[model samples]
Target: MNKLSSAIWFRQEQDTLILEIHVQPRASRNQIVGVENDRLKLRITDAPVQGKGNEGIIRFLAKEFRVPKSYLTILAGARSRNKRIAVRSPRVYPDWMTGSIQRALFKIS
Candidate 1:
C-alpha cells in the first residue's frame, strides 16, 4: 500500500480503489469538500430520500473518476450519511486527489 492507500479515507485493492466518505445531502451543488474526521467529505445536491442521494453520489463520483456508473459500487452505508464506495478501473483521478495518491494510482495502473 502507498501513502494514500494507508490513509483512513482511501485504499486500493488490486484494480479497485475504495473510499470512505461522509456526505452532506441537499447542498447547493455537488462537490467534494475535502477530508473531515478521516473521511472524504462530499456535498451533494440531491435530498436523501429513497436512494436519490446515493444515486447522486454515484453519478458525481463516476464523473469525477472518468468511469461509468456501473464501475462504481456502494459497498456500505447505503442508507446513511457515511458511505464506502468502490471504483473499479477508474480512467481518471479528480484534481483533489493529487500528489501521492495520484502517483500510487498511476503505479498500480
Candidate 2:
C-alpha cells in the first residue's frame, strides 16, 4: 500500500517541502486533525468557498508548524478540497515534520 494518502514530497524547483492535504472543508474547527489510516485529515474553520478553506489550511498549518504564513504557499488544488501546501523552512529537515504532526494531533481538543 502507498505510505501516504497525500504525498508529502520535496519539490526541487520550488525549494520547499510540499504536502498533499485531504482537506475537510467547513469543519467545526481548524486543526491538523490526525493521520487516520494513513491519510492526513485536516479540520478547517472556513467553509469551502472562494478559496477560504484553502487559505485557512495555510494559516492553520503555518501556526501549527510555528512558522510564518509567508512560508506556506498553496502549490495546487485551489478549487479542490485536496490541496498541496509548500512549507519553506531552511533550518528544518524532514524528520521535524513527524514531530510537528504528532504534536498537532496531541494538542487538538
Root-mean-square deviation of every model: 4.5, 7.7
Stretch of 10 with least lDDT, candidate 2: 3-12
List clash counts for every candidate, in order: 0, 0
Best by TM-score: 1
Error of 1 at 58 (Å): 0.2
Q: State how far residue 107 of model 2 sits from its true place (Å).
A: 27
Off by over 4 Å in 1: 1-6, 100-109
Error of 2 at 109 (Å): 35
Tens digits of per-residue lDDT, candidate 2, 1-109, equal 2333223332334556666567888877776665444446677879988777877888887776668889988878888866677888734443425665454446564
TM-score of each: 0.86, 0.65
Worst ten-residue run, lDDT, model 1? 1-10
Instruction: Please list the C-alpha lDDT of all candidates, in the order they appear.
Output: 0.86, 0.65
Please report the candidate that would top lDDT against the real structure. 1
Candidate 2 TM-score, C-alpha based: 0.65
